[model samples]
Every structure is written in C-alpha cells, then in structure tokens.
Target: MSWTRKDLLAMRELEAGEIVLLVDTAASLQEIATRDIKKVPALRGKTVVNLFYESSTRTRTSFEIAGKWLSADVINFSASGSSTSKGESFVDTAKNIAAMSPDVVVVRHSSAGAAALLARELPCSIVNAGDGAHEHPTQALLDLLTIREKKGHFEGLHVAIVGDIAHSRVARSNIHGMRKLGMTVTVAGPPTLIPPFVQELGAKVSYRLEDAIGDVDVIMMLRLQQERMTAGLIPSVREYSRYWGLTLDKLARHARPDVLIMHPGPVNRGVELSPEVADGPYSVILDQVSRGVAVRMGVLLLLAGRKGGDGG
Candidate 1:
C-alpha cells in the first residue's frame, strides 16, 4: 500500500492495513540499533521539529533519538519560556515555526485537535505525539509492535487496558488499533473515569479489574492521569489503588501466567501498579520505550523520504 498521508493525526482515522505497514516498517529498521555505528542515513538532511506545548519526557526524547539516528536535523520547541509565555496564540506560534520550512512537525498540545489543526495549516507532515485526551498515535503503534513481537500475532488476542480511561489518549489509541487488528479490548476503570460512549470505539467496558484481567492475553496498566483529572473521578488515590491497581496477587489469581504487563511510564508505583509487578518478568515497559525510537524513525522516513541510502 502507498503511504500518501502527510500527517499522522490519530489512530482512529487509520486503516488496519496502514497500521500494519507502519509496524512492519519499524521492525525492518530495528536492526540498525544493533549495528556498532547505530546510525542510519535514511532521513539525513530532512528537518524534523518537535513542537510540544505540554511537558513530556519519553515521547520527546524518543522522537529526538529517532530523528538523530536516521540522520535528520532535529529541533525541539516547548511552550515554557517561549513566545507562548508572552501570550502568543497557538496558531501564531506554530506559524512562526512553520516559517523555517521543516519537513515534518511533531506536535503535542493540551487541545484534542491540536495536531489536526497544525496539519491543516502547516505545509509539512505532522506526527501527533499527543493532543489533550484525544490520542497518542506513535505510542499505540509501538505497543502494537511489542505485542506482535511477543505473541507472534494479534488475531484472537485479548488485551485488557486498566485505569483512567476518560482522559487516556493511550487507551483511546490502543482500543482503536487493537480492535482493528482483531484483538478483544476490555477497558476497566472506575465509572467516572470511563468515558461515555467509549464502546463506540469497540471496547468492552468493565468496572471490575478482575473481570477484565481474567480473560486477557495481555494486561496493559495505564497510569492515573492526575493532571487531566476532574473533580471526584475517584474517591481517593488509596481507594482507587485498592480496587483497580495491579498487584502480584491479583495477576496470579485472575490473569494468565504469561500475560504481558505494560505501562506507558512515569508510573505512580504503588498507585496504578505495584513496583514488583512493574519490574517483574511480565513487564514490557522498557521495551516500549526502546521501540518508540524505531517507530518514530519509520514514521519520519515514510512521510519525509530519505535523501538516499547514504543520505546524499
């Protein structure tokens, strides 16, 4: 299939074939990391800019590494201490960066459609790092890559995603991607944290963590999104943990022994997951981080073609 889209706005808009292509492309590029030189010239001379409005560690750093490894010129921009601090409008700030003629602009903002807004206005490819609680496309892609690598296939797999669903861009993206690939997704969380009409995305909702985990091939634990929380979503952190948190005892009793445990990171330790479980044998949190670089590399190379194999 041809890759025509100049922007990756959301997983919800991607076809199943498109998602598979991305995963395969990234897999082919994974070998570069093993080379002694650890560099590829596929995207040399192509300019990639990170335009982030919100704070980030993993997403920002991963994209930066991806661009650099592929030999692209990478620039980073954030809202703090920038013109946005002086009351610059979001569009105006983006427009100023657009004037530099980058090949791709990777953006993360607090607004749901922020990446889409930039895609429409900018004359370059846009990769959605994240936008509000809407979606995180690359993160979802990397998760799929890991699962596929581990399980050998996605068909007939059950993935249970647990935690703050109402404001989880990760959960939303995962639901869309997994369902498209024929995996059953059950989103388990407290009622208030589960978004209304989430079933429209083709997920089974359950308020019980045990019920969700009992039949899953993979257990994806989501972080408690405190920053995006509204009032009264949960009675308290302690109470939420007591009910929804993934503990060793819970997993042993409810989930499959080989069930993969995953978290997007900056985990709240004892809150969403126990430290034992997070660093235990089932966890793939670190692999997810490593794969982000390759996934972003694939996205960049696809959108903005290589100068040449040697980056000439």
Candidate 2:
C-alpha cells in the first residue's frame, strides 16, 4: 500500500500492513547511521518543527537528529520560554507555527488530544511524540523495529509490559501495535496502576511480576512515575520495588532464558529495574534508543518527503 496518512496519531488507527511498512522502512534506513557522512537528501527542502509543551531528552533530540540526517531543516520549540509562558494557548501557538508553512510538526504535550487537535487544524503532517497518556506512536514503531531485529519476527511472540500502565502512553501504544501484528501482550502492575478495560484492548492483566514474565519472550519494564507516589497509587518506592522491581534473581528464577529486557529510558535505577538486570546481557534498552532515530527518519520521509520527492 502507498503511504496515504497525513498524520501518525496513534497505533490503534493503523492497519497491520501500515505498521509493517513503517518497521521495514526503518530497517532500510539503519544503514545510514553506519555511514561516515550520516546524511541523506531524502527530506531535503522539507522543514520539520518540534513543538514540545513538555520537557524531553530522548524523543525531542531523536526527531531533531532524524530530520537533520535526512537533510531537512529542523526547528526546536519549547513552551517554557516561548509565548506559551505568557499565556498563549496551544492552538494559538500551533497556528502561529503553522503559518510559517512547515512540512511536518512533531508535537509533545501534556494534553491527551493535542496531536489530534494539530492534525485537525494544521496543514502540515502531525506526529505524536507523546500525548498525555494517549500514545507515543514513533516509540512504539521503534520498539517494533527493535523487536523484529532481535527476535526475527513478531507473530506469536509474547511481551510482558510491567509497571505504571495507567500512566504510560508507551504501554498503550505498544499494546495496540503488538496485538495488530499478532503478538500477545500481558500488562503487569499493581491493580491501581493498571487501568480499567485493558482486557478489551487485547492485553491480559497480571498483578504479579513473576507470573507475567515466566513464559514471555520479552519483558518490558516501564518507568515508575514519581507522581504516582504523590497520587497515592503505590505505597512507597521501597515496597513497590520489593514486589515489582526486576532483578537478576527474579529473571533467573522465573523468566525465559532467551527473554529480552527493554525499557523506554530515563530509567529509575534500583526502582523498576535492578542495576544487574538493567546492565545485563539480556537488556536491549540501548538498541531501542538507536532505533528511535531510524524510526523517526522513516516517518518523516514517508509523511514529508513524499510531498515533493520519492522519499528514497
């Protein structure tokens, strides 16, 4: 199928083939990073704007590098020092940026539907970096690319996503993408952390970490958001670690020998993951970071480059 979407808002809205096309495209672009020049003209003459209402390190930098590597002009926008601090509304800020005629706007906001709102209002393609607890489509796509590279396939593979599910857009996007590609997912966390109706989203729920990881091919640990403590969701970091934190002992005793460990970063050391397990041989956290740039490049090429060129 030809690339037709103007925006990538969520994995739930993508067909399985569309998801596969993105993964394959990312795979093809992985070689660019290996080259010394590390630049391509795929998106030359195109402009990408990163409009972030939230603080970020990984997603923001990854998109910037992706656009630059593809030879597109990239602009970085932050809400803290911008007109947003002077009470400019999101729509107003976005419209002001859109008036400059960017080819793509990659946005991250605390509001859930912010990306969708930009998609409706802006003439440029909108990529959802992170939208409240709604979705992080590129993160999920990179994760899918990483999984396919490591495991050689997606169908019938089982992934256990553990920790802070209710507050994790990464978990939500991964569940939707994985299920569509015939991968089974199990979400494990405290009952309060797990949201209602996740079963309807095609994920099995497990309260215990051991139970969830035992037979799965991949164990994805999510960040334990600090706000969860203030929100009274989990009792304490110490207590949560005792039950949910992944350690070498836990992996040795319960999880499969070939199981892959993954985290979406800014990892809370000794919180959701032990030092040994996080740096262990099974961990592919770093691979996910590298794949992120490739995934963003693929998305930009498809969405922005297609407008004027073959995007190859």
Candidate 3:
C-alpha cells in the first residue's frame, strides 16, 4: 500500500483496503497487549512526542501506552502544564520538539489542520490525535473496530451518529470510517449543529432523532463539545435534550434488541444521552476505549514501517 506524506488529517484521506488493514492489524496486536512483556522491538530507540494542546485523558493516555508497547520512548507536552499556555506558536513549539529528534509526533489541538501543517514542516511522522471539530481519525478507527467486533462486519449496516456534528472531530472521522467500510451512515442532530452538505460525504442526513435511530445496526452518540459551545448554538440543556437527546424511550423506538450503542469518552450524561442507555446492555462505549490502545499500536506500527504495510 502507498501512503501519502501528509498526516492522516481526516478520514477522507483513507481508502477501504487501508481501513481494513489497520483494523485487522490492530486485532493481531491486541493479543499481545495483555502479556507480561508487552513491549515490541519494532520502534526501539525511537522517540514519540505526545503534544496535546487540547485537554484529554483517554486519547492521550492510549497513545502514550501504544508508543511504549512498540518500545518507543514517550514524551508528553501538554498545553496547560507546559510552555504552550504562555502563548507559544504551534510551529515554533513543534520545531523545538523536532530539534530533539523524535521519530513521530502525535498531537491534539483545538484548531483544525494543526497536525497536517506541522507534518509539512517536520521530518518526523505526525499522528493527529484530534483537531478542532475537524477530525479524529484514530478515535474513529477504534470505534470502527469495536463496532465490527460486536456486529460481525461493516457492509450494509445502518449507523446513526447523533449529536454535535459541527463541533465533533470524532463524528467526522466516524463518517469517513463507516462509509469506507460500506456501512450506511446518518448524521442526526438539530439543523443548527449539523454541518451543511454532510450527505455529500456519502452519509444520509437527518433532523429527527427517532427517525434516524430506527432499525440501525449501530448508534454512535458524539460528545457535545461544551468547551467549544458559543451563544445560540444551543439554548439550554433541558431544551436541547427535548429536541435531540437520546433518552431510553427514544432508543426504544429504534430497538432491534441487538442494536449496538456507542459513545466517545467523558460523557455528558443526561444532556446528549441518558445514563440508563449509556450503561445499558447495548452500549459499547467502554469497549471503544479499550480497543483504542490496539488501534493506536496499529497506527504507530504502520507509520513506522513495521510488519504491516504502510497506509499510503
């Protein structure tokens, strides 16, 4: 497989075969993740920097673990705890890190395309963790892995992604992954929050929650980015819940008894999804997090030119 030099800034950059290869490779690597000696010699002596300008717990930690499992030294650079909060530019910051001669730099920032921009300037490989409501390719890959594990395959499955599409990098990534895997995807939310022409990306767009949920194979609930919210996007939590929220009763309308439910980390509880449905039998939210490490391992290995093919 041939991969371009640009970092995987978005799912639009991936082909179907690449997605399958990454997920399959991740499944193989997951077997070794629980072992007493989990480290691999694939990336030995390589340094990988976790440069996160945005806040995170799961994505950052999983990437760090993935780098360690591959036997690469990990350096974490957080904005809040580092010099970045003091008004340093991304390019200068990246150049400083590059001066240290790292093999790969994994970054998450509040601005879209930050990773791609840095990739062009640095000699090292760049992995995008999440970029400002633009894309989270790795997160989407892990979510796809979880869904396929629970539902056998991706072809012809109806997947409904509910909530905050305009502000969710995860939602964009999921749409790309679902379409690549041959699943039918739908973005459901209030018209204000959903992006325009989302259907042009091979997804069916919907404005009603109950209608989109009916008989789908998977239901993906995106986190409402409270930190990114501005005035008028949403009126109030209670009011927003009434219109677009996924209550147990709302989910009941779409029940197939085997319909898989999914969500990304740090849930907003009653705001976007009800607690009952989130922790219920159908939810694969926790599994998504668990599969993250393996998927990340696959990504790192692929980029480092290991056993598997490169993602070009």
Evaluate model 1: give its lDDT.
0.89
Residue lDDT tens for model 2, 58-156: 999999999999999999998854345579888898999999999999999988988999999999999999999999999999999999999999999
Model 2 alpha-carbon miss at residue 83, Å: 8.6
Give the alpha carbon lDDT tens digit for every residue of 1-312 in model 1: 767788999999999999999999899989888889988777777889999888998899999999998999999998854345579888898898999999899999988999999999998889999998999999999999999999999989999999988888999999999999999999999888889998998999999999999988898998986644447677778888899999999999998998999888879999999999999999999998888888998998888872224342
Against the true structure, candidate 3 reaches a TM-score of: 0.92
Better of 1 and 3 by TM-score: 1
Encode model 3's per-residue lDDT on 210-302: one tens digit a residue.
888887888888777665346578777777778777878877766577888898878889888889988988888888887999999888877
TM per candidate comes to: 0.95, 0.97, 0.92
Clashing pairs in 3: 2-312, 3-312
Q: Where does model 3 exceed 4 Å of error?
A: 1-6, 81-87, 227-230, 306-312
lDDT of each: 0.89, 0.94, 0.84
At residue 184, candidate 1 shows an lDDT of: 95
